[model samples]
Target: MNSCATSFVFLRRSGYAGLLWVLLLSASANTLASPVSGTLSAVGSNTMAGLILRWGEALSQRHPDINLQFQASGSANAPSALITGTTRLGPMSRQMTDTERRAFTQRYGYPPLELKVARDALVVIVHRHNPLAELTRQQVDALFSTTRECGANAAINRWQELPATQDWPFGAIALHGRNSASGTYGLFQQRALCGGEFRPTLSQHPGASAVVAAVGESPGSIGYAGYHHLTPNVKAVSLINAEGQAIALSENSVQSGDYPLSRYLYLYVNAPPEQPLPTAEKALLDLIFSPEGQQIARSAGFVPLSETVRQQQAHW
Candidate 1:
């Protein structure tokens, strides 16, 4: 059998614990030569801002000649940038929507190439001192959304409303969230809010760090942000699954999809049909899928793609 076949067999037997070695073999087998000099610019996804910045730093170290540029307005900006050909690489926290795909197809006669590079989960967090344990989907919706589109019968306004915090002295729950421009906001609205609108009182921040920071500072606070944004001042609230089991954030839970808010992080490339990817862009991808790149991802608190998924993206 070929090396790819061998890697798949190994993956089945060893799981993600052997992910690094499997990716190393695949990357070595298909490594792209370094480009002497060029600029690689990417736009979109503030949620991925830190991870991509780390990747760019690593890329710069390897190829001193390459200039790296990134803009992290939000995921919404990525599709437009790719469609306008303003950027060759677009890092997005979520997949492009159907309308965005159509627009790209109209502009380039082909859909943008989506490469799933990592996985993450959205975590609901509270100040460390809060004793509240887990929340059901309906409770999360009611707490954050005035519209309560997720079938929450009424608004959850105070700490005492939930059984876990009935004895707390807090009168009202302080809420924090991301602004409309963030993909994090969009995903939370869709999944947690059930396509509903947030309460008018929800404090919206420009980035994940800000949301996390706001939650950490407020004693009666509750908010949601990417799992990586967790800090010592705050703790994540376990989310109860449909089966009535509380699902805490963990490497295994996120990877296995037991985490309710699990999501894929992507790099949407503007490579057209019947052509090779640009040298700098291809080199960036090669490094991203390499062991070193995966290590950067893991260090940034994002989950690396499994070898099977890596194979599909590597060939893309």
Candidate 2:
């Protein structure tokens, strides 16, 4: 009878140990299923402020535990912030220069992970009341260049001097542009002005919105900005090439490489997260390459990437 009791006691203890092991394993699995927690900070690209703000709001709704903060300063400050470890993500409207890329890699010991988020067309806007419907590349260049006849300070300041003048407005053309530090300014200098310097009379506005507002209020004024900011009071002029073909800016044209003024919008990140990114941050970026995110990008007046680009970004 004593030996039987010993055997029963052993069996009971063995069963208890097995149940404890099972309980521990279940707890571990539950912990793994929980979402990661942390904060994500991003800066730069005032041009992308509206879209990202909307994205952040949506992301926060799905992830109540994670914090996402953003700032809409000039794009030139983004790379600097990244190199100095002040921000984890940097949004830019223009591509990085070779010198800037080399400096960043030297400081961080790795190249940045660049993700193309959207595409924007550089839109030339004029007052809504203006009758000019299109502008040739040369004519646009002449308006911003300084020379004997077309300089900013020249006395022949009327729009009638341009090529198409049947119903031209008889007034001086006032120009408004972003400050030198703006990514839009850099893009305009390279693509529209053909690397030529801006004229003296070109007024420097604080931001793209200001440029749009200034142009909208002035009858003979002109300005350029991302197509997303075009207002009803401002008319977007069609760009004509040297061959006299008018090209409208649209997602179809931009994706087909037919829009000469379209440029990629980028989100620059560290090679690996220096500080742990919340699950929501990772998921938000993942969704950006998803079909749903692409749809949002299109609706916001930006071009979505092709399937090929989306596949390449999946690995990043």
Which of the numbered candidates is closest to the native, going by highest lDDT? 1
Q: TM-score for each prediction?
A: 0.85, 0.80
Candidate 2 — number of clashing residue pairs?
Answer: 0
Q: lDDT tens string, model 1, 178-255?
A: 887677888999999999998888899977889889999888999999989889989999999999999998887887
The per-candidate count of clashes, in order, stands at 0, 0
Q: CA lDDT, every prediction? A: 0.87, 0.76
TM-score of 1: 0.85
**Global Cα RMSD, each model:** 10.9, 10.1
How well does model 2 score by local distance difference test? 0.76
Off by over 4 Å in 1: 1-35
